[model samples]
Target: MDTPKIELTKDGSNTLVHPKYNAHYHSTAGAIIESDFVYIKSGLDFFIESTQTNSVSVLEIGFGSGLNAINTYRYAMEHEVFVEYIGVEKYPISLEVVQQLNFLNFFSIEDKEKVFIEMHQSIENKNLNFSEFFNFKKSFQDFSTINSLNQYDVIYFDAFAPNDQPELWTENLFSKMYASLKPNGVLVTYCAQGHARRAMQAAGFSVKRIPGPPSKRHITRAVKI
Candidate 1:
């Protein structure tokens, strides 16, 4: 795979633009802000508050830059929550590209840069226990190949846009996601298209359109009920 080009987001964090697809790994306006709003607040925080659970198992669809994974880890540490993060990515970014990202600048923790490096360097498909509170694993596989059943509490569906990858937004894939989630499990995505919402609904999820991050009007949150 061609190495993605690093570009500075509006929030001063780096986002990768795919060489072939010409799509960005995150919103150009702000990478960190987008992840925080769409995945952390809308998905992780909501799950924690609603279930009152100290442990959360999250499956992320497109672990492009590892931004979502690192942010999730940070959230777990700050809240004293136990997090099991499974990130799936077909095209893992080159470490050289990862080294260029400025994600650590937004964080304030001892050796946070090392933690970020560890996230990228960790072995794929094998669980890496970063701490008693955090377990992480990266799957170098496509999301459609995931056949897990009732295994996750939340999913960060941060795949490329539907217009860019329409097959990923289909009802068939949404059905798989619905099956992967435990009852009441939530799936959050930045895509708020009507067809995507209908796809989730057709897959048996209770879909809701929530306020989006900066520069976007709305996002989708679907629950397995």
Candidate 2:
């Protein structure tokens, strides 16, 4: 594995890195929080709450630093919600890089670092269900090739911007994702591009734009209708 060159962005708080995928991952608004702003504070948190499913499955497009997965697991533990987290990443970051992430600084307690460490250890090739709240499967593969009947209740399309990875944002890709979603399953993403919305619509999803976090103007949500 190549060593990652970590750089502090101009804000002096966000830790930006050129990951193995030639993409960047950083906290929003100079906050050490990772998935909080993108995955939690956004409508995803509310979507999960509204669904009120006793056991739910989630599919993540880009695992990146595993921030979203970790945050979701922590939230499930706190709420006693049974969650199955499946994250897909073509280029996964090394465990060392994930450990260096400062996600807990954005939270109330620094002791959460230990929890993150345990989360990393918990991730394995096969689904490892534990704590009665978290079950995870981390895969290194392209999402387009994945074929499965509609199963997941929620989908987190956290891939890089369409400008960078146009293929991943295409109508064809969205069609595949649509096939992977159960009826009424919702998909959330940080992209609000017109073409992206059209592609999702072309895949039979009902799409809508929503307010994003600070620095980001808009986000998107789609439902498998």
Candidate 3:
């Protein structure tokens, strides 16, 4: 892992470019927009609609820049949904970098900067009640060490690409992910690679390709069977 340098996506949102991975932390087309389509609409909203549940638990791999976390928190506040999120990041970014992002401009809430800063700087492993509807915890560890079984309703697999982080996108890891989710729980990711899909299928998931965000052809959503 390397210190990711900040860059602007097509949607004018900030994203980080990892030198070691040689990849953008998010899509070059858009950061927040991509998250909205893949993570929020496909994962969170889809789970809520299918299960008719007011509360949902989510596991996010590669919590870089806290982009997805803040987006999820904002969504929960807007929709009055209760969200319990676990954000896993082995190499956490500094609060100084987090503050440089323009994510707060996307929301209308008061003290958005303060809230976002707090989330980025939160203590690792301890649950933080961020709001009435959103509870967050920063799991300061490697994604491979995740051991939560049959726990989360949805997973935002936001890790780097397979070519960059091959170990994270494997059958063995997918098996763990399958075990980490409740029956029928889903895992959504920007990746639609054949290897990833096969690995998910091999791990007992029902995988499918769905329409992607702008500038992308497809993404994967794997469901626990």
Candidate 4:
């Protein structure tokens, strides 16, 4: 696959457009808005609210530009929540390209720029918690190889659209996700297609449609019970 090109989103954050998928790495309406809304507020905050826990374990698919992870870490710091974040990605973007993106401008804190850089520079498969609230690591492999069982408190199913990457949205993949999450764990995504919901249901998840971010109608949230 060719390297993705950077584009400015509506909310002023930068995102990448995949060559093969022909889709933006995040919502074109607003990269940060979409991630913060769908993955952080809806996914992580909902989990925290339901469990009333100061610590959380999160597993994210399609770690793309690391926006969602950064947003999660930011949320953890602000809320005094400790997070163990595992980001899974198959094709890791280059550090050069990562540096070019304007994700740094999204943070008002002076240290957050360093945080973003260090996150990309950090060695893959090595858990690092240099910060007070966040422990993070990346798995640089195909999602199919992952077989974690009851390990995650929340799953950020942030892969490309169902049509763009149809293979990843299948029942088999959702079953793996169901197994990877603990009981009562929730999976949130920007997809709400009927077939995807059915596939998730077939995999034992109770699926529901929820309000999406700007420019999106509805997203999906599924739970393992």
Candidate 5:
């Protein structure tokens, strides 16, 4: 895979631009804001409130820039919630490129910066406990092949847009995601396309369209009921 070019989002956070796919790792409007809204606020926060659980297990479909992971880590620490985060990335960016990203600048805390660096440095498929509240792991494999069953409370479906990665938004792939989640597990994505929602519905999810981040009209939240 070619090295992704580091670009700054509007809010001064970094996002990667894929050379081959011609897509961005995150929204250009604001990387951190988009991740916070779609994954952290809509997915993890909603799951926590709905389940009232002290611990959360999250499965992220695309762990491109590590923005969502870092944000989730901060949320867990701030709220004293235990989180087991499993992120899947088929092609991880180089550490040098990851270092070029301006994501850590958003945090003034030394420990949070260290934790963010540790998250990128950790080996794939190896669980690294950043703290008592946060357990982090990465998988350098395709999300479609992940077969874990009934293990996650939330799914961050942060793949590229459906037009860019149509196969990932298919019913077959969502069926796998549905099977990976526990009962009533929620899957949130930045996309609110009709076909995508219908595909989730086809895979036994109760889909809902919700407000999206800046520049985006709506996002999708699907639950396995």
Candidate 6:
């Protein structure tokens, strides 16, 4: 993939549109505008908020530009909750490009820059524990072929849209994810394609259709029942 074109939005948010991925951060209209839409509105908030467990483990299919991770970190901080955020991404972005994404300003204190750098650099495929509020493992591989089961409390299935990558949305892939989640764990996505919903159902997820943000009409959330 080509280097993404880095640009700033009117709200001073960063956006990177590469030939393969158009990732946007910190804007109201971009790809990753709000956690409410990308995570919360998709019912991730409900799972995270309602869980009584001391430590919550999340498995993200595509870490992408780290927008979901960043937002989840902020949420954990605000709620004083413990989280273990694991993600898988086949094509990891360069460290420099990751730095250019500017996640520090999302927090209130200027010292957040140090924490941001630490968190971003700590992501590795091997298991790593970072403090009480955060920990992550980056599986530098495809999600469909992942072989773990009954590990995660929440799964953020935020792959590129089915139109962009159909292979990631198939029934077989959802079946893999279905086995990956702990019983009653939730999986959320911004996609609501009919086939995708059917695939989730076929994989044994109790799916729900929810309202989406802006241009999108619907999003999907599934519980491993």
Of the candidates shown, which would achieve the greatest TM-score relative to the real structure?
A: 1
lDDT of 6 by residue, 1-225 (tens): 567666765445665665664544233355445444757445556775666665678888877677777677776776767888887877766778878875456556333556555555654666555556766666777776788889887888877777778899999999999998898899988888999999999999999988877766778889988
Q: List candidate 5 stretches off by more than 4 Å.
A: none
Better of 2 and 5 by TM-score: 5
Cα-based lDDT at residue 61, candidate 3: 90
Model 5 local distance difference test score: 0.90
Candidate 4 lDDT, 101-205, residue by residue in tens: 887677664477777777787777998884788899988878877899999999999998888889999999999999999999999999999999999999999
Error of 6 at 167 (Å): 0.3
Q: Write the per-residue lDDT of candidate 1 for residues 1-225, one digit (tens) a residue.
A: 988889999999889998988999999999999999999999999999999999999999998899999999889888889999999988888789888898888877566787788878877788788877899998888888889999999999999999889999999999999999999999999999999999999999999999999899999999999
Q: Which pairs clash in the backbone of model 4?
A: none
RMSD to the hidden true structure, all candidates:
0.9, 2.8, 1.1, 1.1, 1.1, 2.6
Better by lDDT, candidate 4 or 1: 1
RMSD of 3: 1.1
Worst 10 residues of 1 by lDDT: 107-116
The CA lDDT at 202 in model 4 is: 99
Model 5 Cα lDDT, one tens digit per residue, 110-150: 48767877778778788898888999999988878988899
TM-score of 6: 0.86
Writing each residue's lDDT as its tens digit, candidate 3 over 1-225 gives 556789999999888888776789889899989999999999999999999999999999989888898899889999999999999988888776777888788888755777788778888888888789998898888888888889999999999999989999999999999999999899999999999999999999999999999999999999997
TM-score of each: 0.98, 0.85, 0.97, 0.97, 0.97, 0.86
Instruction: Flag regions of model 6 displaced more than 4 Å.
Output: 7-12, 21-28, 109-111
lDDT: which candidate is best?
Answer: 1
lDDT of 2 at 218: 79
TM-score of 5: 0.97
Question: Which of the predicted structures, 1 or 3, would earn the higher TM-score when compared with the native?
Answer: 1
Clashing pairs in 3: none
